[model samples]
Target: MAHFDSNFIMSRILLTDEPTQIGCVYLEAGGIIGFHQALSAQLLLVVHGPASVRCDSESEVCVSVGDAVFWEKGEWHETKTETGLMAIVIESEALNPTKYMPVKLIKD
Candidate 1:
């Protein structure tokens, strides 16, 4: 957790395994997580008040409690909030080929 001012605090929790990852981030009002890209398919869940997101190929979107967003692997995205925001983030697969076996599309 980090305290930025009298009214703002940021916190995060993260976990991962070979196939997936789960994380939660708490961002206070006006806080930003910055522009970035996901290495694998991702699911972002907004579990608290208003947050906004910007992703490549789309316009910015405002999200609230119970809202969810999905991002394809390697898609650039960013997140911010004008009010306190709690987001649950999940990513699927290892992403890095060096870390896992090759995927087989079919069985002979």
Candidate 2:
């Protein structure tokens, strides 16, 4: 079973096996870092301040402290800071092959 606890500091917790990883990330004020395409679907859960997300051809969505968003694989996307945002990002397997492997979030 996978588990996590972010009551102390901003952190991340990775769960599940290959091709199906769940993550929980915490961010402080104006903290953001993600512009790469994923090999799988991503589900984001906001736990703190307001967060903004932009997708190809789609208007940015401002998620409140208790909102969630779903992103498809291979869809170029970027997240920005608005108000100290904290979230949980989960990824699923890719539909096609020959893409980034390890099927995991951890790159080695």
Candidate 3:
């Protein structure tokens, strides 16, 4: 078992490669994380701030602090930031979440 910390701020905690092949996310603040189609189901634990997730033609949902959201795989979604957003993403086949919790998730 390994512990990974956020390089950006000290508000986030992470657990990698537990249930699935990937890790789970715990956000401490709010920020913008790009958009893309997921290959796994993302378990979003919003400890603070509000997050807006939009995929395809689906309406955006405002997730506040203490809210837990699950984003399935193969859906195009983008993180909307107004006042910084903190949310975790679950990698489907990811054996570790901490190792994948970076800007690398957002493909360019």
Candidate 4:
């Protein structure tokens, strides 16, 4: 068995604009976010420590506190941690949520 700190919790709140959702996340050393897609153009800023980010067709880059990065809609990317990382992120609900429809799942 393996013990993982699993720093995956994120705090998100809809902005006054209502169409924008802002959030923050903290990742301890060794944390990783596997490849994923962004439904809306997303912006992220490193609040503290260092963050490693890689976008589709691009080499990974290390961004320090105060650095900002953007990913276009539908872009594939991934983030990993070499050290602790803290970041703020924003995504537009108008673009992503408007098309979201939950599918029903039958379970026992």
**What TM-score goes with each of the models?**
0.66, 0.62, 0.54, 0.67
The stretch of ten residues in a row with the least summed lDDT in candidate 2 is: 98-107
Expressed as tens digits, the lDDT of each residue in 1-108 for candidate 1 is 346546764332223466787799899999998888888877777888898888875667777896766677888999899878998887886433223223222112
Better-scoring candidate (TM-score), 3 or 4: 4
Question: Can you write out model 3's per-residue Cα lDDT over 22-94, one digit (the tens) per residue?
Answer: 3444433455556787767666667557777666667777767866555567877776657665555545544
TM-score for model 4?
0.67
Instruction: List pairs with backbone clashes in candidate 1.
Output: none
lDDT of 4 by residue, 28-108 (tens): 999887789997877676888987888876778877886666677898988888888888887874433223323222222
What are the lDDT scores of the predictions, listed in order? Answer: 0.72, 0.63, 0.57, 0.71
List RMSD in Å for every model shown: 12.7, 10.6, 10.9, 15.5
Query: Which of candidates 1 and 3 is the stronger one according to lDDT?
Result: 1
Error of 2 at 54 (Å): 0.6
Candidate 2 residue spans exceeding 4 A from truth: 1-18, 94-108
lDDT of 2 by residue, 61-96 (tens): 666775666667887777777457777777876322
Model 1: residues with Cα > 4 Å off, grouped in runs: 1-18, 94-108
The collision pairs in model 2 are none
- Candidate with the greatest TM-score versus the true structure: 4
